[model samples]
Structure formats: structure tokens, C-alpha cells
Target: MNKFDAIVIGAGQAGVPLAKKLAAAGWKTALIEKRAIGGTCINDGCTPTKTMIASARMAYMAGRSDELGIHIPEYRVDFKAIMDRKSTIVKQFREGATKGLEETKNLTVIYGTARFVDPHTLYVDKNDGSFENYTAKKIFINTGCTPFIPDIDGLKEIPYLTSTTLLEIKEVPEHLLIIGAGYIGLEFAQLFRRLGSQVTIVEKSNRLMPKEDDDICTVMSDIFDQDGIRVWTETQVESLSLKLGKVHVKLDGGGKGPASLNCSHVLVASGRTPQTAALGLENTGVVCDEKGFIKVNKRLQTAEQHIYALGDVKGGPAFTHISYNDHLVITENLLNGRHKDISKRMIPYCMFTDPQLGRVGMNESQAKEAGIDYLVASIPMKNVARAIESAETRGLMKAIIDKKSRRILGAAIIGEQGGEIMTVLQMAMMGKITADEIRSGIFAHPLYSESLNNLFMSV
Candidate 1:
């Protein structure tokens, strides 16, 4: 029998940091993971995806060498080499995580599947069919999530791909049909399209990135159209059939009859679901929602008071950074007696399409829904010197300000470096910095960050 002051299940982004914090605080901690450490972000999701996106961006730039007055030469994408680089990055991060955990004196890193035997007891199952029992004073669940595979007809029978499997492809598909137009879908669409694949996106929602502001979605739609990626909005996949090395999709919208599209490959970027089914929550007092996500309070404490849940398992924002923030908040509450609620944090989101889209705090629609008196100002990318110099001036930057308080209520950017630019806005919103302050701040000339200055100037 093994016992510890805290037991963390799944050593991913959230679990790894929390385990370290608890152990460093002199708590006896056991970090258990069935797979590699550093979770999806380090191993598969964010790191690898972004690495591949970088390669794809380079490929895009090479194709447009004429704009930069570069010599003309034909280039081919080595998909296998790109995957190799991504793999290398994943491996390096994994090793760093392992070494960090191994050096912690008060922490035990266990590689096994952990299942709840009781509210405070768990059984770890090893691959060799061996089992070990563990009891803890507290437990933290950060198992994260998995791709949600819909049960479309013949989807499983065909060689369908998800984000996890798509990264393993050594050769680019001749034609790729993607279902869903959220972040995942758009990202893969841009990557594969730049890699010389004909990409088509079918989104059930009426707009791309339905969670974002509609104006941003409109800009993204235009960019996709200009890039030759076919986008079908408000379309539902009725069924899928495989024939002659091609995928045939039946889609329906409005009262129109079913329309069909053919493609050499199909990728499902629908969404992800919390990975809680195998944890045997029924054996413990922990409660999960209908979708199998563990329920947690403002402090991330589960129904079992001694247990805490974070990241995607808590059914909140499912981003890698969000999971890291979850670790920070929970660690503070558990170790320092500080009461930090996850909801109180300023959360930002981004979609990495051609003209990236990013937002922080209440958007214009949300301000209206909340009945807040707000003023909005927008600046076109063409007016930004940096955007013009970079020849990527095809988006907009918008700011929402509280009319009474003059505080920045929200800011959205849809242009080059939108994700990076949103960080400045996130800090401002978090610190309650007003729009007038932002306007007074001097910005570097010929930089995309200056768009914020321009946006406030428009106000």
C-alpha cells in the first residue's frame, strides 16, 4: 500500500505544475500518468500543432516569394521532415518534464492508469497487469480530454483522421475535407492548404469560430475564400460514405436537399470531450456532468472536498494555458490559503488562421446582452504601417470600452500577430486599465502592436 499527502492523476499541463507546487511546499505528492508527461500541449496538441503551423507558414511565404523580390525557384514540402521536427520538440519537452519531476524529493512519479476505488483510495493498473493501491489526503484530477468522434455512418470504417492521427501523416493529402470550422478546423485547413492540399471546410455553425465575434468570423471567411479553401457554413453532415479511395459527404442546410462533396481524405475537427470515463468516478463521491466532465467549484474543489478537478475535466476553457492557470489558482488555494477563483481571471482566446483572430473579456454582443453602456472603435489593417509593410493588411482591430468607466471592456483583433496583440489587451482588462491610458502609452512605430494605439485613436 502506498499513501501520500496528495495524489495527482494524469501528469499533463495542469497535473505536472500542481504536483511540483505541492511537493515543493513540503507535501508528499504522487504524480500518476498513463502516458507521456507534459500532457497534450507538450506531446501532441499545442507544441506539435504550432511547430507544423510554422512550417506551413514558411511554405506559404515561399510560394509568395515574388512579393519579396526573391529569386524564383520551385520548392516542395517534405511532410515527413516537418513531422520529424514536431516530434523532436515534443520529445525535448517530455524529457524536461520528466527530469523536473524526478528531481523533486517529495514527489513520486507513477506511470499507470489510476482508477478510483473509493473517495480517498485509488488503484493503479500497470500495463503488465500489476496493480497497486494508494490512499491520499487529497487528489487532483487533470486528465484533460480526447477528440470527440461523432458516429457518422461509415466514419469508423473509412480511413478518417482526427487531430491526433492527422499529424502522423507523412504525405499531404491531395484533397482534404474537414468537418467543423472552429479553431481546430481552421488551423488544420490553413496548414494543409499551405502544404499543397486542396482543403474544404464544412461548419455546422453559420459562422467560422462561432464563439468569436461575427465580424471576426466574416474576415476569416473572406480570407479562406481568397485562399481557395471552400467553406460551407450552416451545413450539417448527414452521412459519409467511402468509394474508390475517396470520401463522399452528404450535407444539408436550410430546406435544401442533400448536397454531396468528394475528397481524397476526411478529417474530423469537431471538438474534444473530457476524458473521465475510465477514471471510475462512480466508485468515488466525485460528480461529473452529463458529458462526463468532472464538476468543480470556484476553487476547483470537487464534490469530494478533498479532491480538486481542473482543465478540460472541469468543463471550462479547454486551452493549454487555461490548464496552466488552473494549476496556479489551485496551487495557491491549497498551499498558501489564498482564495483565487478561476472565473476571476482574465481569459483570452485565439484562432490561428491566415488572419488570426483573438479576443479578451466581453465582446460587443456580450456588452449589449449584459446591458452595459459601451463604445466601440475599429481600425482597418490597411491603415497600420506595420501591416502595410508586411503586406498582410487584410483584417481589422476593434476595441470595446465602458462608456462610464472608460475601462477597456474588450478588444478583438483579426490580422497578423492577433494572438500576440491580444496579450496586451488581456493585461489591460485584468488590471482595469482604461482606454485613455492605452491611448497615452507610446507604441513602437511600424509595428502591428501599434494597431492598438490606432484603435484607441479612432475612439
Candidate 2:
């Protein structure tokens, strides 16, 4: 049996950095990964999708260049070229991450699938068909989640795409049908529609992005309508079958939509399932929730005190940033002897659509559910000088403020560069800057941030 001071299973965003830091702090570490060094973010999720989205955004803008007074005769999306670019960037990122792990002192990079044999022991089935048992004083589980495959009839017989496989298509889909309307489905819906595919979204929720406020969803719906992307809400996919070369999808529950549709491709983007099932947690004292996510305390420690769970495996927020932050919390609390609590952090996320939806803190629904007295401020993108000047006025910005404290509770931006604008507001919220200061703040003219002045003025 091989032994180490520490072992990190899954070389994901959290595992890579945590292993490096632990090794740098003088602990011998083993970083075991079943696949590529970078986890979903670099291999499948954020990096590749964002790269393709960038190409799609470029194609979208080139198609409308005439409106910008830059008349272009024509523009075409070379699907292979876009895929190649995405592949190139993904490879670059993976190579960099691999290099970082391999060069780190006292960190051994292992290629294998690891499962707990006990609280401090793991058995690895190496990729080379070899096996090894490892014991460490401390263990960290950073294994991320995978796309959830829903249980629809005839789904197994027909070929369907998940978020991971959708990126590997040989050609652009003729008609792309997506199963969910959350962040993943919406981003891909806009992405393929801009990439010249006939796109349709069938969501089980009553409306698109049910978590967002009604007005935000309305603006997003309007944007999708303008892009010619069809959306059916409160719908469920009953079954799927292959008819000729096309996939016949039978959907139900939409009030006024066709019972079924035939599409060249079907993407099941419903949600993700935690990657803890195969971790052999049953052999250890560590506990998992009903969803198979490892249960961890605020310090990210599992019930087995020496074992820690980080990132999507622990199951609060699934964003890449959240995973990286998990690493920071563990590193600080463990290495630096600081008592950093993971629960004290704010969660910020951005949906990378044409009009990006960036959110931080609480929204109106959460405030109402919590019974907090709140005031709202909102403005359309058409009212923003920068958005109108750029001819991309398709969404709005909304903010929720505490009525008693006059402080910004939460904010949402659904305009161009919405993520960046949302970060500025997040900083203000972090600093406890009151709504009055934001309303009267001097922001540069004709920029998206300046709209915050207009947004908060009405509050």
C-alpha cells in the first residue's frame, strides 16, 4: 500500500489547487483523476461552451453588421472551425492545468478512479489496469457532478445528447431541441440559434428561469422571441424515438403547443447529479444526502473529521467559481489554521446568454419568502445609452433594496456585459454601500455601470 500525507480524488478545479497548496505547505499529496486533469469546467463545461458561445456571438454580430453601419455582404458560421477553436482552447487550458499539477513539489498526480475503503483509506483502479491502495492522514473528495439523464420512455434506444456530448457533434444540428430552460439549456438555445440552427426549448417549469423575477423572465423571453428561438414552458418530454434520420420527441403539458416534434438532435439538459455514488462512501462514516451529495459542515468537513468534501460534490452551488472558493476555504482553515466559514460567502453567478443574466445576493422572490421589506428598481436596456448605441437593447437591469436599512440587498442584470455590471454592484453590496450612495454615485457617462444610477434612482 502506498501512503501519503494527503490524497485528493478528482483533479477538478478544487482538487488541483487544493493539492498544489497542500503540497506547497509541506504535505505529500496524491491527486488522482480518472480522466483529464481539469474537471468539467475545463474539459466540458465552462471553457468549451464559452469558447463556442464567443464564436456564436461573433457570428450573431456579423449577421447584423449592416445595422452597425458596417455593411458586410455575408457571413457564414464554419461549424468545424468553431469546434476546432474550442478544442484548441480546451487543450491549452488542460495542458496548463496538468503542467501545474505535475510541477508542484510533493504532489503526485495519479490517473485512476478512487473509492473509499475506509475513512482514511482508498483503493484506486488505475487507468493502466493496475490497482493500488492508498492511505492518507487526510482525504479530500473533489469529484464533480455529471449531467442527469431523465427517465423518459424510449430514451435509451434513441441517441440523445447531454451537455457533454452536445459539444462533440460533427455538424451543426438542423433543428436543436433542448429539454430544460435553466442556464444550460437557455445558453445553448441562444448559442445554436445564433449558430444557424432552428432551436426550440421545452421546459418543465411554469416559465423560463423560474428562479428569476417575472419581469426578468419576460425580458429573457422577449430576447429569445427576437432571436426566433421557440420556447414551450410547463412542458414535459413523454418519450423519444428515432423516425427515419430525425429524432421524434413527444412532449406534453404545454397549454398550446404541438404534442410532438421531430428534430435533428435532442439535448437533455435538465440538471446534474452529484458524483458521489461510486465514491464508496458507504464504507466510511461520511454521509450523503438523498441526492447523493456528500454532507459537509460549514468548514467543508465531512462527518469523518479528517475527510473533506468540496465543490459540486457537496452540492450547494455548482458554479466553477464556487468550486474554486471551496478550495480557498479548505486551504485557509486547514493550512493557515484560520477558522474560515464557507457559509459566510456570497454566491454570484452569470448565465452566458446573448444578454447575460448575472445575479448576486437575494432576488425579490427570496426576499418575499423571507419576509423582508424590500423596494425594487428597474430599467430596460433601451433606456441605457450604451446598449442603445450598440443596438443590443434586448433586456433590463433590476435591483432589490432593503426598505429599512436603505442598503442594497440583491441585484440582477440582464443586459449586455451584465456580468461585469453585476460585479460592480456586488462590490457595493459587499461594502455595505447604501442605495442612496449608488444612486448619487458618479459613474462614467454612456457605460453600462452608469445605468445603475438610473436603476437605483427609482428606488
Candidate 3:
């Protein structure tokens, strides 16, 4: 048995940084990873998906070039090239993350599956077919999540793709049927449609984005419709089977959709489930919720105070940036003698569709549900000078403001460069800047930022 000062299972965004920092602070550390370094974000999730989205965006823009007075004879999407580039970028990022850990002093990188033997002890089944046991004074579990496979009948017999497996397709799908209409499903729906696939989205929810405000969902639904993607809401996928070299899907509910459909490929993007069951948590005091997410406090500490849980495994915001922030909170509280609680931290996220959906803080519905007296201000992209000039005017900008305080509460930007534009608003909210201040603020002409001045004018 080997003993260390700290041990971090799963080398994700949170685990990597936390292990490095702990080792740098003079505590011996061990980071055990079952697969490649960098976890899902680098190996499969964010990095590869965003890279392919960029390629899809290029194809989409080329197809729309006629509106910009540019006559392009022909353009084709080289699916192999796109996949190659995604693999290349993923490899680069994974290599970089691995190198960072390799260079860290007093930190041992173990490639294996770790299971808890006790609160402070773990046994690792190494990739080399050897067994090893390590115990630490402190343990951190950053094991991330995996695509949740639903229990639809006949699903196991047929070959279906997941978000991870979808990236490895040899050729563009002829017709892709995606399950779920959350951000993951919607993004793939648009990207595959752009890649010359007949894409259809089936969502169990009544609206496309149930969490978003109605106006936002309406605009997104309209945009998807305009893009020639069929959307079926309040729909259930009863069963799936392979027939005549095509995937036959049985549909129920959502009266408008056909009772049966055929597609070349099926993507199961329903949701994500945590990778905690295999960790043998029953051996320790750490508790997991019914959904298998590790229960943690505001400080990210598990019931076993010396053991901490971070990243998607701990639930809450599952974005990569949030996981990185988890590392910051844990490191500051432990190494720097500072108490930083993430319960009140502002979270910003972006959905990379044709026109990105950027969101920060609460939306109108959330504000109302929380009983906060808030006022709303909004402007369409068609009204923004920059959007008009770019010929990419499609979505809108909306802000929720505190009624009496005049402070910007939350914002959503769904347009070209929406993520970048939303960042400006997030900074304003962080500073407690008022709506009047933003309305009267002078912004450079014909930029997306200028739209902020107009967005807040209504308030």
C-alpha cells in the first residue's frame, strides 16, 4: 500500500488543476484517470464538438453567401477533413493537458479505474492489468459524466450513436434522428442539417428549450424551422429497429408527428448521468443523490470533510468553466486560507448553434419564479446596425433588470457573436451597473456591443 497527501480521481478540468496546485503546495498527490487525460471536455465533449460546429458554420455561411452579393459557384463539405481536424485538435489539447501533469512535481499520474475501499483508501485497477492501492489524507473525486442511455425497447439490438460515438462517424449521415431537444440535441440537429443530412429532432418537452423564456424558445424554434430542420415537441420515441438498411423509429404523443419515421442514423442525446456508481462510494461516508450525483456543500466538500467532489459528478452547472471554478474554490479554501463559496457565483454559458445562444444568470421566468420584481428589455438583431451590415440578423437580445434597483439582473443574447456580446453584459452585472448607465454608455459604432445601449433603453 502507498500513502499520499492527496489523491484526485479522474483527470478532468477540475481534477487536473486541483492536483497540480495541491502538489505544488508541497503535498504529494496522485491523479488516476481511466481513459485519456483531460476527461470528456478534451477527449470528446466541448473540444471536438465545438471544432466540428465551426466547420458546420463555415458550410452554413458559404451556403448563405448569395445573400451577401457574393456568387459562389459550388462548395462541398469534406466530412473526412472535418473529422480529421477535430481529431487533430483533440489530440493537441489532450497532449497539452498530459504534459502539464507530467511536469508537475510530487504528483504521480496513474492511468487506472479507482474504487474507494474506505474514506481515505482506494484500490486502482491500472490500465497495465496490475493492481495497486493508495491511501491519502485528502481525496477529491472529479470523475465526470457520460451520455445517459434511455431504456427504449429494441435500443440495444440496433446500432445507435451517442454524442461521443457520433463524432466518430465515417461519413455524413443521410438522415439523422436526434432524441431530446436540449442544447446538445439542438446543436447536433443544426450541425448535421448543415452537413447535408435530413435532421429531425424529437423532444419530450412541449417547447424546444423548456428552461428558457418563451420568447427565446419561440425565436429558436422559428430559426430551426427556417433551417429546414423538423422539430417534434412533446414527443416520445416508443421504439427503434433496423429495417431495409435504415433505422425505423416508432413515435408516440406529439399528435402532429407521424406515427413512424425512418432515418439513416439515430443519436441518443437525452441527458447525462454521473460516473459515480463504479467508484464504490458505499464504502465511504460520501453520499450521492438519487440521480447518482455526489452530494456536496457550498464549499464543495462531501460528508467526509477531507474528501471533496467537483465538476459534473457533483452536479449543478456542468460546463467546463464551472468545473475550473470548482478547482479555484477548493484550492483557495484549502491552500490560501480563504473561504470562497460558489453558491452565489455568476455562471455564463453558450450554446453553439448557427446563431449562438449566450446566457448569463437568471432569465425572465426564473426571476419571476423567484419572486423578484424585475423588468425586461429586448431588441431584435434586425434592428442592430452591425447585424444588418453582417447580413446575419436572425435572433434577439434580452435583458432582465431589477425593477427598483435598476441593476442589470440577467441577459440572453441569441445572434451572431452572441457569446462575446453576452460577456459584456455579464461584466456589467458583476459590477452592479444600472440599466440607465448602459443605456447612456457610448459604444463604438456598428458593433454588437453597441446593441447593449439600445437593449437597455426600454428599461
The top-ranked prediction according to lDDT is 3
Error of 1 at 115 (Å): 0.8
**Which ranges in model 1 have alpha carbons more than 4 Å from their true place?**
none
lDDT of 2 by residue, 1-459 (tens): 899999999999999999999999999999999999899999999999999999999999998998988998988789999999999999999999999888999999999999889889999999999999999999999999999998999889888899999999989999999999989999999999998999999998888999888988888998899999999888899989998999998889767665988999889999999999899999999999998999999999999999999999999989999999999999998889999988779898999998899999999999999999999998888899999998978888999999989898888999889999999999999999998998998999888898888898876
Query: What is the Cα-based lDDT of residue 108 in candidate 1?
Result: 96
Candidate 2 differs from the real structure by a C-alpha RMSD in angstroms, to one decimal, of 1.0
TM-score of 1: 0.97
- TM-score pick, better of 1 and 3: 3
Q: Is candidate 1 or candidate 3 better by lDDT?
A: 3
For candidate 2, the TM-score is: 0.98
| Full-model lDDT for every candidate | 0.88, 0.93, 0.94
